[model samples]
Target: MQKAVQLEVYGRVQGVGFRWMTKLVADKLGIKGTVANQADGSVKIIAIGESATLQQFIGAVKASPSPSGHVTKLIQTELADVSLCRKFSVVG
Candidate 1:
């Protein structure tokens, strides 16, 4: 089953090429979503894909794709009313 999730990733995520890493991971996973830097020093990701794929995406993200980035916390919320993007991107 397909699903969507809004992820709030905290810690040394901004200015560490986290967004680009996220896009690479998402695209590789065939997930459609958006990754943007939040003002609160967090990275927000909206991911849409198969249930299993989403889980993998989350794990990959948590593993810190960006070598310079550190994820102190990751909060995921299931989203039911989101517009799926055609591909993963690094949005503002």
Candidate 2:
């Protein structure tokens, strides 16, 4: 079954190619959603895909962040409603 998740990644995530890297990972994993920078200096990612794939993607994001990015805290929540997106992209 397809699942959706909202991820709030904290720490030095902005201005460090985090969004770009997230896009790349999402595309590679065949996931669809949007990644954006939050006003609270965190990165927010809404991803939709198979449960296993989403887990892998989230693992990647936490285990391997952008070169200059350091993910200090990661908050994940399963979204009950899925918003299907055409493709994964970086959003404002």
Model 1 per-residue lDDT tens digits across residues 2-79: 899999999999999999999999988899989999989999999999999999999999988899999999999999
Count clashing residue pairs in model 2: 0
Tell me the whole-model lDDT of each prediction, alpha carbons only: 0.92, 0.91
Off by over 4 Å in 1: none
- For model 2, name the residue pairs that clash: none
Provide the global lDDT of candidate 2 against the true structure: 0.91
Over the stretch 1-92, how does candidate 2's per-residue lDDT look in tens digits? 99999999999999999999989999999999999999999999999999999999999889645888989899999898776687898999
Clashes of 1: 0
Question: How much is 52 displaced in model 1, in angstroms?
Answer: 0.7
Model 1, residue pairs in steric clash: none
Best by TM-score: 1
